[model samples]
Target: MKILKLSYFVKLSIFLILPFLCFGQEKEQKEKPELDLGGALRFNYIYSSWKEEQKTKGGEFGYDMFRINAKASYKGIFLNAEYRLYSEAFGGGFLKQGWIGYKFNEKNQFHVGLVYVPFGIKQYNSHNWFFNITYYVGLEDDHDMGFKYLHEDEKWEYAFAFLKNAEELNFGGDTENNSSRYSYDVVGRNKETNQFNAKIVRKLGDSIQHRIGFSGQYGSLYNIDTNKNGNHYALALHYELNWNKWNLKTEIITVSHSPENKEGQSNKIIKMGAYGAPYEIAADFNMYTIGLSKKISVAWGPVSEIEVYNDFGYMQKKEKEFTDSFMNVTGLLLTAGQVYTYIDYAAGYNHSWLGGNFEDDFSTGNPDANWEARFNINIGYYF
Candidate 1:
């Protein structure tokens, strides 16, 4: 097995600097530390058009996952972590996010550890169970091992982060990039490293709230076989509008990756993985997404409210020879006390998770690939 070599100096620096920043605050009013623990159990039922036998049998229902969430705060320091347990088929178990943060004041805060990359939308780009295509391309809700600084006020918010790499599964010895994890990242013979990101959002209006934001990121792609580094960059413009009970979200993103691969490997595609699988994706592409949701109060038994939504995404590969990808999901979210459920009809063409084959869906997709659909319901109870 090849040895994995990480930049120890950078890791050491972060560990050394965080303690000083977290503890150096002048002693003010002493507040008691607080800790909160919560978790959720979820299940899914799916009927897929591509699965002939399953469709003939009606559908399949099974346990989806259970997850634990922890939050602790003391004075100006805080910690947040989440761990998920999935079936063996879905990457088993992994740490979804864990971070330690320090609040300098009301407007400034710093975070270190496996932190979310501030890009595009804030928490989620879509209201549906299946996120937009940007999630597959590692642009939406992606997290990395990094340090981040955030500043927010009434009208403006800003975030800057320096990410060292994707969260590493193996500490020092193993060379293979593990695919058993959440969130897509460069895998195979290449790894993501030395990434930097910046995001700024401007808030406008009160009742009819509007938010406009810009995000940019640049990172390095380290090829183990070639012993060389390539590069990647992405830029996005996003907008969010909320008026009364109606909400809208939209974003346009352009991403490019230039990987220094072995002589025979094609530069047009790179490998990315999540949930125990790795697949090739076009190295250069543009993505567009838009979603709208409206909430309605309900008097049905045990159901308090329902959110109806539609989310659509389009992926346009930069290379003319590669076929593009499309996805659309129409869904409803029902909330009743501590239980929530999602019912969705999702359709896609050349999408990795939707219906296309893993090998070529996001790569050089077949020109004649037909659209496929899935009807799914997920129910989860939280405490």
Candidate 2:
């Protein structure tokens, strides 16, 4: 019965889209050659292997996520939507991201609607259609819901943005009691984040460049005991200097936040969980990371890159004492809350349109969890 209902819905959606597809085709036939109306298709494939530890047993698991994206624009207004079909190996697939936007100026000005946050490296590609694995939107934490601004010229370029809780995923009912086990509430944390961000870039000669950026979010998290306030602020800096065949790149990030537990358990974590647990409380936390990367072209025409990084961090925890078992601390917590060290090393081949992103190894678990690696190859054409 469920499958029947789903099939009916899909048919209805296709029916609704038929008119727009036909209309677009008719417009193209009637318009001048200068009027542009077309869209591109993109494919993404991802695979991961995981190691699990449990008292009874331990084993390995893997999953794959694939996405197909389509986009179209007419004049300054545009629309983009994607369909994700997951294999049975990964449960199933569905639409991942879909939104629309408008271009504001000759320099790529834009006002996006339900669009992907336009504040990342993905916007610029040598192929004009492919993106690097690292080119992710900050708002990827959720669906981008808001506006964007961009400015580009010879010496200076910049981007600014705002996004809401547009792509939150909530599954099933009775979320308050069953969220952790079987449900994914779009606003699972029961919080709405209002984000404001900015990026500025400066060009210095042919071998040197610099970029600085900042992002902030303010919101509230709904917990059982009390409504907790939350906020996140981050600052970023990037610099690159090239000498002959070698290039030096440095990136830095400073982040601060105050978040709460949805189950209202901060107090227990502070008191009985661990001595330094207090620092891990749902209060306030701050961390900073700096990384230096070097890239050199090898005799094989492939570029090799290496990065060394570290994070220094601290936090202020929340306190609570309650008689209920549910309110009591139940797990091991480490306080004194200090990051002694963090680092990662990666060496890989470089190609156009696709590559990989290297991340520091903090190790909650899994070596690859601390980083991401991939091989990408794509093709694109413009008319």
The alpha-carbon deviation from the true structure for residue 367 of candidate 1, after best TM-score superposition, in angstroms, is: 0.9
Global lDDT of model 1: 0.92
- Candidate 1 residue 227 C-alpha distance from true site, Å: 0.9
**Which ranges of candidate 2 are over 4 A from the true structure?**
1-63, 87-91, 94-96, 114-143, 170-188, 212-229, 240-249, 260-264, 267-383
Choose the strongest candidate by lDDT. Answer: 1
Model 1 lDDT per residue over 195-245, tens place: 999999999999999999999999999888888999999999999999989
The whole-model lDDT of each prediction reads 0.92, 0.36
- Report how far off residue 153 is in candidate 2 (Å): 2.1
Where does candidate 1 clash, by residue pair? none
**Per-residue C-alpha lDDT of model 2 across residues 74-183, encoded as one tens digit per residue:** 76677676655444433354444566666777777775555444332223211111121122112212335567777887777777777664443453232432111111
